[model samples]
Target: MIAVPASAAGDGRPAEERGAAGRPSLWNIANVLTMMRLLLVPVFVLLMFADGGYDPAWRSLAWAAFAIAMITDLFDGELARRRDIVTDFGKIADPIADKAIMGAALLSLSLLGDLPWWVTVVILARELGITALRFWVLRHGVIPASRGGKLKTLTQGIAVGMYILVLTGPLATMRWWLMAAAVVLTVGTGLDYIRQAVVLRRAGLSAAEAERDRER
Candidate 1:
């Protein structure tokens, strides 16, 4: 009888098989949902600007598209983690889609004079800066989304949806309040992520030093 390799006999499977088992497929339900969100961005913009952003019916349609896109964001991450279908593409593309949708909405509103340009500028600046920082430290480690980050996203979505509805009087005032909260959370979470990056960098340096010592 032919003898099995000792390593294979102990684990009953080759290393490649184990690695393949843990690797996620690129074309999964979660990634599909993410792609759907990205596709809806242009649709949202078209609907918003179809009637110069003044028509009530077009605004309603725009809001519907934006709401659906936000819902996809909520589910895509959950589905990826639960189904074990998380991939590098999903991690990178998911946040990009989120930023694109929000940026489009904010910029469109500012252009239409529905929202202040300052607000748009501040929020977009924070988002793009943090995105760049994430990639900068990618070699050292990843900064996962914190609880505050999720809350910021939720608040931003609610505030933008409210603005898209173009509410009047009391509801309009409420929208401003919601936006204020979102801005606070956005800035606060951004600072937290910067701190996390510093910690991760230090940890990576420590790991490298320990490895070098062991080698010596």
Candidate 2:
């Protein structure tokens, strides 16, 4: 007979397993913030295209909506972690919200002829591809966020924000370089995530095989 660890609370499972099984409710504050971000996506899109897509006032309002979405993105995950209320709903919805708002901004700018179509395609492709990869390997394990990924997000946000605003002269030129950096970061981090995902999946498969052998 095996002795159950005290941390398992007499259930014979590990504490970590228990924690995963008893995830917090979906209605928590963290998930609410993520939902708010998703709802802002359409609002941002409408504002971006308002006044024939060039009125500075409408763009400013769009920028305000984008900024709020970004700010909430930063807080929701941290709030979930700190409060120990991380939920599956948040895990899935948070990234979707992040991508939706960013994608909407990029697509709107490209449609307005403010940004290059190729640039929008590249960024959106990377974002969507990485998101697909995450779900592909989700049963194995999560690919933890890297510093490069965070930098990519920051650079992309700033570049997009600059484009949303009506700028001229030297500032306009600078935004192009910032966007270039963002594109490079997007591709670089995306490839790194793919590598990590492959490795994680392999490890998870090996562990599963070993467990089956033990059971046999």
Candidate 3:
């Protein structure tokens, strides 16, 4: 009698099954949520500018849309990581969705004279620069989110929400303060991510050299 090897037995399964086990599905719940966030961007912009930022009803609807979109950002990431359904599509689409929503809100506010253009320029520069930096360092390693990065997101969300709601009096003053805090946090975290990229590149080089030494 002849004995078949276990490896050969496993290889006898269909290619589709093997691929499914090794790679994440693109049409999972997490990716759907990310796509939904992207879809919400235009809706948010339309609602925000429908009445020239004057009518309370339109402003309220815009705020609701923005809030829902932000909530999805939180859950989509959590679900992806928890369910082990992370994918390259999710990695690329997630940040684009986030920046799109925030950018729409900031640009609308500036155009309506609610926010200064300078604020929009600074925040956007940081976001786009960091995004480019991430792609540049892909050969090295991923930079995980730090506590400061999370704080910056939170503060920026709150500031944008307040701005969309178009609050007046004391609430208006509070929004400026929140935005100031967000700006500080955003700049600090941007610098930190650049530093982390340098460290990760050096570590990757060291590991590669050590592997060569072992092979020799």
Candidate 4:
């Protein structure tokens, strides 16, 4: 009954399930880091708003915290992979953590008038949509992360970083360009994800139909 947010990384496990190891999977090291990342989202948001949205030091600190949290996004997944400890729970938790961070940051920025609501909506929607599509594909087996997807993530991460830093320094004008890049990548990767999702869905339907035919 865990009504987890759509943006949350959902390795498809409920809150209480364990993998083959008989350990509380929610406590798995990798997922624990992901949860920590999720928890940090509000701290960043709070700091952003508490400073009246313009305190340079607070802004810098917020961005630094954000960047550090983002690093965990990379490391946790890699560690899971390298250790062959990937679990369904990890799969779900990782993405949820990522989206929570992105959505929270984007919303905070938009709240302070640094970003427009329309733009934030597009970005947030794509993030959530692609994630849901990913799980749909996952049900069919591993659909490896695409190069374009990685690029999208990279650009968005850096773009958000720049926008935050812009608030801290005098590079305010570049905010528009950073926003533009995030938009472009969001659309591009969203399309790519949709394409893959379609292919998988069609393939799955065909397999299901074929199995039905076998008994006839």
Candidate 5:
């Protein structure tokens, strides 16, 4: 049986690889956009909190920034696919940037009474729990981003954006639906990760048993 080489395998030198070698890696264009998303986080926060009697205007700017960030979330992956610039760094940084921005926005909204405290807590708990789990499982192997996981992220972005944008009356009902979608996706994806983790563990155990049998 042939084992996969850790590096590019020709030179045999692993040059401190951080992201996926695919187009989504740090070299990838998608990841550049992901970095842009991270860069915008501070600006968004500043726009959110620079309230010197222009609270509503600043809030509106914050919403627009959030909207742009969310749009990038969709396009970066598409751009990676189209341009074929995916990388490992893209995977790690993309998600981290996503969670930081969303988490900050949600927390701010909750503080301002735009969203329910429980909703913010639920969203944040899901984000942190998944991130910690990702690192824990990385020791065993890379967990390729699943389709369901991507869907969950899209839902999360939409939900958080809706919550932030619908601060006024009337359209607030739509925001509630978005939040419900996010919650459902979060729970579903969490379960999906648990199942994947179990499968990976079982696969490792089976491989070990096979190796032992060969030795015997």
Candidate 6:
């Protein structure tokens, strides 16, 4: 019997990498954008807390930094896919950079007393927990991000951006509703991810057992 390479056998490498002969460089635009987002996390935090943590001008600066980071995130993955430059570095760092920027924003807002501590804790817990779950089941299979997950991320970004800005009367109330929607999406999508991971792990284990039986 001929042996297949692990990559070709889909032993946890991304589908795109299977049967591919060439590797992309780590210095591609996608990775650069991800790194930029990671760097902006600290800048956003500093600007968020500047001037007693409530100055409109400083908040605006922080919001600009955040907006830029989000924009880069939107572009980076598409660029990587279209250009066939999806490096392993990009796959790992992109998600970390995303969580870092959003985590910093949520935590900073809570510390400043702008957002409720519970909101921050819940969002952060979901984000971190999902990430850890991905790694936990990584050897089994890669869970592709669902459309609902993308929607959840979009809602989170917009809601968090609204909270970052100083608003008045009706706008403030609207932001609250938006944030409520974000929380709902966060929890809902997190549960969905967990379900997918469990299914993937079970399928992978069953497949491995079948292969062992065949070998014996």
Candidate 2: residue 189 Cα off by (Å): 0.5
- Deviation of model 5 at 197, angstroms: 1.1
Query: Can you write out model 3's per-residue Cα lDDT over 1-216, one digit (the tens) per residue?
Result: 798764445543333323354555787778889999899999988898886776778988999989988999999989877766778899899999999999998998898898899889999999999989888878878888899999999999999899888688999999999999988998999999999988988998999899999999
Model 1 lDDT per residue over 76-124, tens place? 9998787656788899899999999999999999999999999999899
TM-score of 2: 0.85
List lDDT for all candidates, in order: 0.88, 0.90, 0.87, 0.78, 0.74, 0.89
Candidate 1 at 174: error in angstroms?
Answer: 0.3
Model 2 superposed RMSD (Cα) = 6.5
Considering every candidate listed, which one attains the maximal TM-score? 6
- Candidate 6 yields a Cα-based lDDT of 0.89
lDDT of 5 by residue, 1-216 (tens): 787664455222224322444212354457767998999899888887776413877777888998888888888877765655556677678888888789889888777777789978886887788677767766566667788788877877777776655355766777788789888888888878877777777787788899999999
Model 5 weakest 10-residue run by lDDT: 10-19
TM-scores, all candidates, are 0.85, 0.85, 0.84, 0.82, 0.75, 0.88
In candidate 3, the residue pairs with backbone N, CA or C atoms under 3 Å apart (3 or more residues apart, or in different chains) clash, namely none
RMSD (Å) per prediction: 5.5, 6.5, 5.3, 9.0, 7.0, 7.0
lDDT of 4 by residue, 34-106 (tens): 8889888989888777658778778888898799889899898887666455777888878888998888889
Off by over 4 Å in 2: 1-25, 212-216
Sort by lDDT, best first: 2, 6, 1, 3, 4, 5
Ranking 5 against 6 by lDDT, winner: 6
